[model samples]
Target: MPDTASDTTTGYQVLARRYRSKTFGEVVGQESIAETLERAIDRGRTAHAYLFCGTRGVGKTSMARIFAQALNVTDEQAEEVAVGDAILRGEDMDVVEIDGASNNGVQDARDLIANASIRPARSPFKIYIIDEVHMLSNAAFNALLKTMEEPPSHVKFILCTTEPHKVLPTIQSRCQRFDFRPISVARIAEHLTAVLGSESIEADEAVVLRVARLANGSMRDGLSILERVVAAADGRLDAALLERVLGVPPEDIVKDVASAIGAGDPAATLRAMATLLAEGLAPERALDGIAERFRLLLAARVCGDDPALLGTGSEESAALVEESSAFEAEQLVHMIALCDAAGGRVRVSASPRAILDAAVTRMALSERFARAASLLAGDVTVSSGATSKKKSLKVADSTRPTPPARPASPPVIESAPEAAPE
Candidate 1:
């Protein structure tokens, strides 16, 4: 499956290319659409133009390439290709893949238009697969529109883009639009398992999940991250080393921080910070990890009942989501904001430890910040609530109340010292 051989080039295929889906069957999370395309071709109802639309790493380009191969398919008696070795090769016959970002100009398109008049050189049909199709210039799109409106019977056009909304509706109307969904974590995990085992490299499931989680629903992005991790680890991976390499704050740290937050124990939270500092974790990174957890909690609350909508298939994250209800959404938002701001500052600060200390103190003590706001607003009810809370906590009455004026003690102490000097 790899394009590389010998020491001439890097042996590593790079996760995206190495694990690329050569066939519709290998495409994860797009089975229904793949089946539809297969049936369409089988039934001789295949459209001349197709638009594969989705976010990046969702297999838009890959599907376009596959369809292009399908147009020129000849290995089997079947009309469409089955993504075999021959189809995967994408030889210099009828199938062609072009980057739209660079070839979106009218001149380039005019060249394509000039060539469209010609018939397929050898294969059944000439297939033009254009990626990032939305990048085409207005003039180029206009030129494409004419061809798409009425193309030769032997030509097939496959347009792919992450931003299909930018594409002209005229072009869209002429094509069969297929939306590619983001790859699920389960799918990414499965692919990673196959790829890793093939390479004879063993890694923890949590490490793979972390790579997948950071990918943010992009299979290409996930693979890219996984490649980086593999390279950084020098072959074998340890959970702590992997987390450190990827800048992921450890899972235990996140859980501890969140649990401390739930219990409202500032000291316990500060102790957790100290433990991370002992582990050689930077204050800035620790803060970022804390922020990431709170962000996760925010997402958990949003997708309270729907695990699928969360776009993750991690059991730990699912458990985190279930346990996340103990904290209010506003609390997570508040902590996330604080951690983000603190992390930003800590990164630039010469004394990150001091900044971390102050940040934790700020978060812990900030609960009473609204008391001052309430006082200024002359809201008696809020002041009473504060007083009652302090009473419930058994803090001293003197400490709870606003401080009275410091009277004549200063003058008396100065006189006694002056008297001794005289």
Candidate 2:
């Protein structure tokens, strides 16, 4: 049987929509913003306009809907499920939800302004929730400015955008802006655990944590990933299933590449990288994995094996701590920087494989450069490892002429001249 949690008589609703935040308390990772809005409603200090800005899959749109429901639904009517449901579904007469991307013309703004003057049909206030507001055209924004500045007392506006910098400063100034931060990995993991429990899905802790890391700080994204895995699990979800389904590089492959780089073995590094590519991993993804591995190593070097900082399971953390011992913090930083630069180039390069290979090789050879730098800086004695004593570095100047065989015969004549002068 299909999972009843996601399937309904009407149809199947994706987990992102099915498990969306319905109340202020349900919103994850944006607790501060939720609290502020709730207080605003309780104190009757709600602003005429509110700007919710954050990355995709965060709680911006969800919060917008919840805030609208709070503004229009009274304590007595709150018990009436239909009223709250209609507003949440954007079907209420007093609450309007507009997609700024599609209807971003001047006429749309004029129509919105025209509708703003109408009082609420049943609720106390009429609220406009415009999503992706940054996508609205300049003329459309201009048309709404006057109304936004001096709208009727019964009208309220909630604007949400992933790219707030694209929004005009004038429009931004008219609204009370709230910035939503990316959810942390720990928070995402905890939320995913709860979601799995509710769905009656038994997922390994490692699998859940991997999904959370893959979500990259978006709760909605975390649900979507979990939903996909659950659909294919057939009531069984494990690390192996996740690897096959997601096609993500296995942890061992990434560890091998990291260990090779740390050992300064370019051949081994390339071999490990080839294995990853042979597994059908994209070059960009391979680079990302390598970079993330180095990041974990760096974190381990600096912070030890703290799970919170490393964002890995206990075994993975222990492995990272062990591997990080092979490299200094500075070497890891340089390796990460190399990966970052190569990441940008690989996207636009004609031969992305070559770029990735070059990055891997450079990372493997990074130790030589680090040693050279240390020797030049005279920070510490460097050894070639073949000798028991430290090796001294002597810099030769090519522009300066070498002293000829004059020193072989100069001592006898120089002593006689010095004695005569005295």
lDDT of 2 by residue, 1-422 (tens): 23446465667788887778899999989999999999998998999999999998889988999999888888666556787888877888889999999999999999999989889988899999999999999999999999999999999999999999999999999999999999999999998887777778898888988898899889888888888889889776898888878888777899999999889999999999999899898888888888888888999999998988777789878878988999999988888898889989999999999999999998898866766677778544546574434443443344567778554544444445555565
Model 1 C-alpha lDDT per residue in residues 147-254, reported as the tens digit of each score: 888888888888988898899999999998988887777777677767777667888877776677677778888878878777877657667777767767787876
Candidate lDDT (C-alpha), each:
0.75, 0.87
Candidate 2: lDDT of 67? 94
**Can you list the residue pairs that collide in candidate 1?**
none
- The alpha-carbon RMSD values of the candidates against the true structure, listed in the order shown, are 14.5, 7.0
Candidate 1 C-alpha error for residue 245, in Å: 2.3
- Top lDDT prediction, candidate number: 2
Model 2 ranges off by over 4 Å: 1-7, 76-79, 371-422
